[model samples]
Target chain A: MLRKMRRRITIRIDMTPMVDVIILLLIFFFMTSTFREAEAIDVQLPHAYAGVRIPKTGVYHILISEDGKIYADNEPMQSREEFIQAIVSSRATNPNLIFDVKADQDVEYGVMLTVMEDLRRAGIVRFNLSIFKEAGAW
Target chain B: MAGANVGGGEGRSRTGRRRISIHIDMTPMVDVIILLLIFFFMTSQFKEPHGIEITLPKTDVPVKIPESNTVTLRVDENNEVYFNEEPVEEISKIREYLIARQTENPNLVTILDVHPSAKYKTMVDVLDEFKIAADETGVTKFSLAMKREETAPEGGGG
Candidate 1:
């Protein structure tokens, strides 16, 4: 009875270390994560099983939100003239420069096509899309 | 018995009294740092700033582009400009933004994804901004984000 009483009645697994590590990891991902806003547009993106990460060191980016918003690298531009001029300058140095487009899924298809047509008129022939891979975990 | 001492000793070891050293190879850390730095450097993404009041056309295209460092321009059905994804109200602002990106990386390029119903004129106007800025600030070279059209029915079939 005495021995039984002396035996440890409770056991504990120290999760402090694990919790500390998890905190550190979370902080790391948050700090270093280039959290490009997936919600830049209000539209629910049409989900697909395919997406590749394109490194954007040298590409032009365009965004169209669900509300029909237009942005060039996050700057709100007012006229077609300004938009075209920007593209032309980008192309002047690297004829192979590409455009990365992000638009709300609800944006009119006709509008997107029209923009491409305008590019051809300005003598630009190359561009690509910038998309996010499925959210697996940060 | 040994594990308890080992665990308890962890506190004492921190005081550096016993001279026990924990060796963590920094090679992997360096590799990860370099890789992440390269990724952020290469992706060169900008913030979204402006928006217009137009709706987007729905599509069933199943292909999605991968995430990368890219310049994005958004267009609405009414033909407006949004930088990065935000709505920009001034040409000068757009000019400065382009110049800044070019300044950061000489090889920096751009991408344009517009709503299909967006106005053709709006697209032209957006391109014009880049061209003018590049000319004034010396930003050269750009790319389009969309595929070429098989026909030119734009501008009311011109």
Candidate 2:
């Protein structure tokens, strides 16, 4: 008489390929993407007849929304403390980064004043707000 | 949560004679990920910095500013923003603004002016505000007009 034999189970996967692919993708994005030195929020910038394109340089872009919300490179900060830390980090990497601010047309004047004050306190030397052409146009 | 359950299956498994370990030490990985998340969360920059509302003006003439170098400020129809001609922000942004100005070396300074049909007082503020940024940065050479007709000088527009 012969005894019955049981089937064996074997499952092995090489995770190296997947991890390698993920790391490769990360590297690709790191090299080909534009890392915003500054945070920019949702604010419809007035379209210019000629919104000229400048060369690639250390420039910071700031966006202010209609509700007067501020963003740095898409990251939202609640207070000056958060803003300062973000600026300090950007300055560390790109000291020459120029602060380019874009605010909604309907934003309050006093609110802008406070934002400027905060940038000054944080040590941003240069910056400008963007505007579109005349009314009834883009 | 989904991944935790999948990885947890091997966590409590008893070791065989050979003791083949298949667990991914998620504790350390999770710690590292959390730390990185915190670092980025703490370091990210905010654009608004502060909540300020100012209506911007629309200019029939669109200015060409390159992606880099220039700092643009807008003035809306509301005269609340420094009488509508100046920038709402202070002098800090001026240095960079002027630096961009000099770098571009444009025949004219591209100042965008948008004026909506708001109240007269608001319009005045929008037009007259935010000059300090330019003044502080020492960028005086500029132009003040909408657009030189598409017809252009001697018909540049085709």
Candidate 3:
């Protein structure tokens, strides 16, 4: 008499390569990602082809809304004098402070010149005008 | 010599010092790494911090620029563009004019004179054009004109 025999085979796959790739991607994202901060005012920046990538720190923001209201570092200023005073006082502490003007697209051009003149009076000769990158403008 | 060989060459003693096969499960570690990766990937914004630079002179002293090497672009309230005080019907004329003028004269000084009521977007658009022209000519000389009391009268063409 003969007895029938049954055998089982197990297959294993190597997950090392997949896990290694995931870890590499994880590190890349962790290093390059920056959390977005909540903005005090919503500004619709205009598109421009010529601009440089501004740094994250050591800069001050002068925001102008579409309604022609100005804000210094997110604080609404009643007049241009207050804005100048704020910049002058801030410059007293940090001489290397860079002024960044973030104005809405609908804002008047005259308002920008006024802000720039005020910045010049506050001893700020060089400043940045923030703009969105136009894809095909270059 | 015979006593030295008694236990030194035993195969059982070598087997006793063999390294143990310790298998560590990597499923949990990989799961955590994938979770963190997803979180970062979702929250990351690909926005480049872009801005246009403007540098004003420290002193208010006005420097004289020759008319032969000067180009003034003036924008009005209705986003109408003017090239060298001449109203341009087609905006592309300004770009072509800038490129041609800048190529002809490297020392060309471009002035921006914008009316107060004009939209800010128009100024940036014109500045972008100037930049493109400058890149081709390898020279960039521009200034923001002081505030004008009133808008320049519109003309048909020059």
Quick one: best TM-score, which candidate? 3
Q: RMSD for each model, in Å, please?
A: 19.1, 16.8, 6.4
Interface RMSD of each: 13.3, 10.6, 2.0
DockQ of candidates 1 onward, in order?
A: 0.07, 0.03, 0.64
lDDT of 3 by residue, B1-158 (tens): 34533666677556666576877888899899989999999888779768888777777766667778778899988989999878988765577899898888888888887788999999888887787787777767787776676332211100
Question: What DockQ number belongs to candidate 1?
Answer: 0.07
Candidate 2 stretches with Cα past 4 Å from truth are A1-41, A47-57, A133-138, B1-158
Q: Per-residue error at B143 for model 1, in Å?
A: 19
lDDT for A112 (candidate 2)? 55
Stretches of candidate 1 off by over 4 Å are A1-16, A23-32, A37-44, A49-51, A93-96, A130-138, B1-158
Candidate 2, residues A5-47, lDDT tens digits: the string is 6456566565556555555654555455544344345565543
Clashing pairs in 3: none
Better of 2 and 3 by DockQ: 3
Q: With candidate 2 superimposed using the best TM-score fit, by how many Å does residue B85's alpha carbon deviate from the native?
A: 14
**What is the C-alpha local distance difference test score of each model?**
0.53, 0.46, 0.82
